[model samples]
Target: MAAAPRGASAADFETAATHAIILDHRSGRVLFRKNPDEPIPTASMSKIMTVYMLLEQLKAGTLTEDDTFVVSEKAWKKGGSKMFVEVGKQVRVGDLLRGIIVQSGNDASIVVAEGLAGSEEAFAERMNEKAQELGLDNTTLRNATGWPDPEHRMSVRDLARLASLTISNFPDYYGLYAEKKFTYHDIEQSNRNPVLYSFDGADGLKTGHTEEAGYGLVAAAERDGQRLIFVLAGMESARERATESVRFMQWAFRTFRNFKLFADGEEVETAEVWLGEKVRVPLVTAEPLALTLSPDMREQMRVEVVYDGPIPAPVKAGEPLAELVVTIPGVETVRQPLLAGSDVARLGPMGRIAAAVGHMIWSAE
Candidate 1:
């Protein structure tokens, strides 16, 4: 198995946000990150998980778009963003989903929670379970609405990971995130995700803000054939979050490009064989080496074949013998195993004796 780059340094970039990350969706590569693992209040970004849980049930055939849930008094009176759902009025699952996603309605989240799990508190427990199932270690969900609870927190990386999973796992329902405007009960509001309105190829995901969590966004975009997922949090204001998010996405797509570094079965180097019929064996990678890099750094990329010199005889074809170490100036070093390209038989007794004599002469010099 080959190791991937850790992440490139981002000292050259500027942003008002305190926590942020950018990832290559196809390759799962971390292009840039700042305090990505630090746990912080996610605000309504936690709603992504809530929406994801509902989507899972939808995919499982346990829930339907047409199914309706009555709005309880709790949902009707809940503050923050509103979908204006009337108490005791039954609302379809589909409309509530749109309400939560587009309108950021606290009421819609509570209704879905109670309808699905009998209560918001019980539904929050389900969110925590789903977080564990998704391998999100840094996330803790205390409510479905992301209601500014002290215990409701998630890392920026987890938010990006959730966004990636939502896009990949539930393609059908993912379109809800892209809806520009959704009206329920004659109340209208545009999607809060700034990227969707500002940039081309920007699709789904969510945004978050509160007195404790500041302003944040979990966004994804696709251009050409590549996709990128990004997360930002702890911004001073919504304007700062929107401005920095667009600039960062533009730089990610414009400044970096994917390049093929090595072709499969292409010999990268040769390793010496000791006391064998063949003096050397070709070293090659089994898979193509492709990487995303900035134009200026491509020239700085280096590949080195490292191994114990003069590999022993009786080496088998396709045996692991060495490693190809790849390094770039601002990126972490990646290593790929290099395999022996062919078998090599040991030298006969007379040939070995002659080789020993040559080795002694070389050592004496």
Candidate 2:
């Protein structure tokens, strides 16, 4: 986008008790934030961390959908958004997922915690470690279940990051978030995540609530092939969260668009080369890359490419030789590899001498 889009404020959510934020989940661009770093209890939205952690076990083959879990009295007894699992029953990973995602079951969350980390407290400790690794600077882990604890807090930006990582890192498990309803032990419980049926292209993420936390939602949506994720961490009611989420998604799609700097191997891009006949081979990116920009960005966008000049006779095709850069202020420059399009056979002694002379002559120009 050449121009900036309309902006919202965390301050605008007057009823919100904590910071509010909206971000482009795809682009990792912050659309709006109010006290964005102020950490507040995320309610069940903290389960986003739980989901990600469990997926690790699944990927490592330590857990499987068919794996049976013996429901403990503790799991059966958890309060808030439950799949109503019965005690002394066997719950498989697939069904437990329904309880966790669809129902936001505190029990399921705890069970997964224990199953993976041997204790809910240990899993909560891991959650704290992960928070540090993800750079959730303002987030604090209080428990595996996002009960209304005073210390269990996260920022709106942090929540958005958690949601984004979940989708990006786990495509297969991401589908579970879209399931609208789940049955546990013969009881049907629907997902609390409202975005799925309320709006088009809305899927994924989690919702949270508490008397103190108010209503918070992390929702994602896609439109016109562009995906957007929204985080509203402290709304007074569910209505505002849903409304704000939809509005933010629309704003992101219409206000920002992508610009391409150059096609891959268009020439003159800088890159690193190893063990080539030439000291520093020219480079090109294997593929073209683009950037999402504001409308005003076009005025400042700069593209620079640097590569080894007309390679020696010994140059070989497909060698990394250079790099192409698309620079946008306030964003990392895009670098793509540049490669030799064709091979140059090794030069004889006379050929090398002649080539050196030719190089000198070309340099004179």
Best by TM-score: 1
What is the per-residue lDDT of model 2 for residues 1-365, given as tens digits with 9 covering 90 to 100? 11122234545344333566666655576656677778888899889998888887788888899997777788778887777767887778887777888889998888778777778888888999998998888888877778988888988789888888888888888988899988766788877777787778888889999988888888887776566667776678888777766665566566656555546655454333322344444454566655555676657777777665554446777876666566766555556666775555565677667767876898899
| Candidate 1 local lDDT, 1-365, one digit each (tens) | 22334565557567678888888776667888888888899989889998998999899999899999999999999999889999999999999999999999999999999999999999999999999999999999899988888888899889988888898899999989999999887777999999998999999789999999999999999997678888989998888988989998998899777777788877989999999889898988877777777777778888788999899898998899999888988677877888888899999999999988998999999
lDDT of 2 at 308: 56
* TM agreement with the true structure for every prediction: 0.81, 0.79
TM-score of 2: 0.79
Task: Report the C-alpha displacement of residue 177, candidate 2, in angstroms.
Answer: 0.7
lDDT of 1 at 240: 90
lDDT of each: 0.87, 0.73
